[model samples]
Target: MNLWPTYRCAGIKVVHIADDWSSATVRLKLGPLNRTIFGTAFGGSLSAMTDPFFTLLALKQLGRGYIVWDKAAEIEFVSPGRGTLTSTMTLPPEEVARIRAATSTGEKFLKWYATSIVDAEGRPVAKVRRQIYVRRKRGSC
Candidate 1:
């Protein structure tokens, strides 16, 4: 995608983006580009993989009436984060429906979600938490 190099997240390639509105996963690989001096994936890159999913998923499933944001985030470094890291993001049908029901009344609230950062071999390297604000825009929709 055009955004891979624009934001310097080239190593953070999006491997799977399904049209059914169910899932997405950002892939990481070991190479000279995104590596640190210790030969590990950069922590910032790991964190960056998580940014847009929450908002994009919400918009895709909930339609145009609501606003979603990456309100807050925290990460736990569980390993050396060597070789590579992959972050998988998913939004279940029930949760998406819940958001629509809660915000349909035109009120705003802060919501939170979390994901795990895993190595190439599927070991968890870190845990990430994200907060999003949901609301309806005035006079817009």
Candidate 2:
């Protein structure tokens, strides 16, 4: 679901969508709205980079009869992101299947996933863990 434009509208840029899964790389050009007091990228902006991908991918591959939401989250800032930050997200087929199987009974389940934010040199600047909560639709397959 085209979240890139929405991100860009707020000054974050969607760099690329990997051919594998719905994992995408999104970057933001620091501006008044997103700049920190010292003029570096704001923590909130950096944190927001991990927002949409994993759960979106889960929803798409998981198909109907399920709802996905961010359940738990942790972000470790390894360094202050100055410029050109990139975040990558991916999900494997088996993981998708597991989540699906676990929630097939209309019971809610939480799944853990991760994403890494790297600098232009490909060194990790931050690691984000996303816990996705899923629940099945009533009387639906």
Candidate 3:
């Protein structure tokens, strides 16, 4: 089940997912349902829009032999998010390799990734940091 479309009700739209699962772009549109009383994007919506991406991307790249989950997250609102805002999640190949190497012995790996939510004009609205937990499943590798 692809979570991108499933999360649309929250005003989060998945704009793109790279073929390699190394990158993804998601947009949070400012609408009645997702706006605050100040007419800006709701803070909760901004946080929710970024909730599952890092873990999901890692899961896809790590394959079935690995277990991945969202361990923690933090969002700093820099400015009121007006109009449509977007954030791109990217995991470099080196990072993936490092994760794999670290978890090769069935140990857990926790890595933090950062992304910026920017407005239509490309100004920063918020900064989101997500820590993902990953491990190699026992007997699978």
Question: Could you give the candidate ranking by TM-score, starting with the highest?
Answer: 3, 1, 2
Where does candidate 2 stray beyond 4 Å?
A: 1-6, 18-20
> Lowest summed-lDDT stretch of 10 residues in model 3?
1-10
Worst 10 residues of 2 by lDDT: 1-10
**Cα TM-score per model:** 0.88, 0.85, 0.94
Q: Which portions of model 1 miss their true places by more than 4 Å?
A: 6-10
Can you write out model 3's per-residue Cα lDDT over 5-74, one digit (the tens) per residue? 5467668888898999998998888888889899999888899878788998888888999989999999
State the TM-score for model 1: 0.88
- Candidate 3 or 1, higher TM-score: 3
lDDT of 2 by residue, 14-101 (tens): 6777554656778766667777788777777777887877887788777777888988888888977766788878877788888878
Candidates in descending lDDT order: 3, 2, 1
Model 3, which residues run further than 4 Å from truth? 1-6
Higher-scoring candidate on lDDT, 2 or 3: 3
What is the TM-score (0 to 1) of candidate 3? 0.94
**Deviation of model 3 at 7, angstroms:** 2.0
Compute the lDDT for candidate 2: 0.77
